[model samples]
Target: MELFSDDFTDGNALAGPLREIFAVDMTTATGRCAGCGDEGPVAGMKVYAHAPGLVARCPSCQQVLMRLVRGPSSAWLDLRGTMSLRIPMPAE
Candidate 1:
């Protein structure tokens, strides 16, 4: 059960690891919210780092957008909460 209402932070908390996953800056990446269909940058999401894993939630409807769990051997990623993530490719 959740006991604290102030346990949430901004998406800057996940910037490091998320950057490694996508190999790019996620702040510029657009994410489509599955809950309310809101489309915006991932950096706009609300992040909860109080748990073992980091959860990114939509700022519009407070819906989860992403969940990341780092383990000794591997890392787990859950993007089911987001309908789509648009990553921009650099020009060659």
Candidate 2:
């Protein structure tokens, strides 16, 4: 049997889906880890895509930052593990 390692990609993998929810790019947003209080860009988080949903974890403490699941008619986004997300916007 093949063992699973820490083979994962950066949070950039979420850009496509996240764009469907928000008008702006979410990969550039900053997320604060609720578990370790570490803050970094969403693109810097570790993303495991071999599962049913996308699991994003904090790089500092390996804490779950968010989970996104998409279906035919709906999508579920859980960000409870993330303290807050600082999304940059264009000047109005």
Candidate 3:
């Protein structure tokens, strides 16, 4: 599914639509933060995922952040605005 939008905010908002497109368990999805250089849960952070992967939000600066981003890994959305970091799924 397409990622990000002028109207998008939280990851939960895209979870349903994203799952419909990727057909993956968007509920258990997780990723690191490319903005704060931290890795953790992706719950409260605004997020979005596409063919590239997931884009978790950084809860520190509210930037459209990402994580573990190297070659073909999942992307992330920066959620530093509402919180420090979020993990929708339970810690592993």
Candidate 4:
């Protein structure tokens, strides 16, 4: 139930803004779901971009993990639904 059966897409749609905020490829990052406690890479989550903002939902429990609302002045990002976001460090 976490993933949508119809039009859910990958997190690649959020790569641009994620890079600008985290300075790294965040779509490949891992996020722990706050609802079902499931942990997985962001790329596996279901993304919906047709709304006023982009919404990413957990693939395990269908809980909203993140939302990105782009405004004319500044973009508003909400990640309260995500338990934690783990960004991989570059290998030396």
Candidate 5:
């Protein structure tokens, strides 16, 4: 049996949900995968939204890069799978 479903959307799908949590566009940010050491734009990751929340995985090694769950009044974000994320910010 398959442990994971093949149905999923691209990282671009995360833009709306993430915008609620971050001030910047997270899809354009770059992240380093803890499992594979691969660094790339979050937009290049694969996003699965069928679960209770959103799960984003590395495109190179398929390692989970992040997870975001939204509640009625709050939101939870997990970045355990990513070593680090470089989010762009506008300079004043």
Candidate 6:
């Protein structure tokens, strides 16, 4: 996927537009990892712009830390995650 300077998808940079299009929540709630279950200090949250919606990811394992869904009383889509870009191999 083409990486944008900002976290917002399509470089819209507007919360309202995104909310209208996808489900999202900004206020994030911290929780222990379901996979590892090490609750000392969870990895920092990062924003990831996906096709369906924005997602949060744990820096430790690069797993989907959280998902943002549009809520009535929510603001911007909170995403604490990272994205991996796959550079297409040159045609042989």
Which of the two, 2 or 3, has more TM-score? 2
Worst 10 residues of 1 by lDDT: 1-10
Q: Could you give candidate 6's per-residue lDDT for residues 46-78 as a string of tens digits?
A: 446554655655544545655656557764444
After superposition, the stretches of candidate 1 with alpha carbons farther than 4 Å from their true spots are 1-4
Query: Candidate 2 — which residues are off by over 4 angstroms?
Result: 1-4
Show where candidate 5 strays beyond 4 Å. Answer: 1-5
Better of 4 and 6 by TM-score: 4
The top-ranked prediction according to TM-score is: 2
Tens digit of per-residue lDDT, candidate 1, span 24-58: 88877899999999998877789998899999999
Scored by CA lDDT, what does every candidate get? 0.86, 0.95, 0.48, 0.87, 0.91, 0.42
What TM-score goes with each of the models? 0.87, 0.93, 0.42, 0.87, 0.89, 0.36
Return whichever of 1 and 2 wins on lDDT: 2
Clashes of each: 0, 0, 31, 1, 0, 12
Model 2 residue 46 CA deviation (Å) reads 0.3
RMSD of 1: 2.5
Candidates sorted on lDDT, descending: 2, 5, 4, 1, 3, 6
Model 2 residue pairs with clashes? none
Query: In model 3, which regions exceed 4 Å deviation?
Result: 1-9, 47-56, 66-92
Error of 3 at 34 (Å): 1.2
Q: Give the TM-score (vs. native) of candidate 3.
A: 0.42
Candidate 4, 79: how far from true, in Å? 0.6
Between candidates 1 and 6, the TM-score winner: 1
Which tens-of-lDDT digit does each residue in 1-92 have in candidate 3? 75465433565655554455455555445555555565444445555544354455565555665332324444443234323323354467
lDDT, candidate 5, equals 0.91
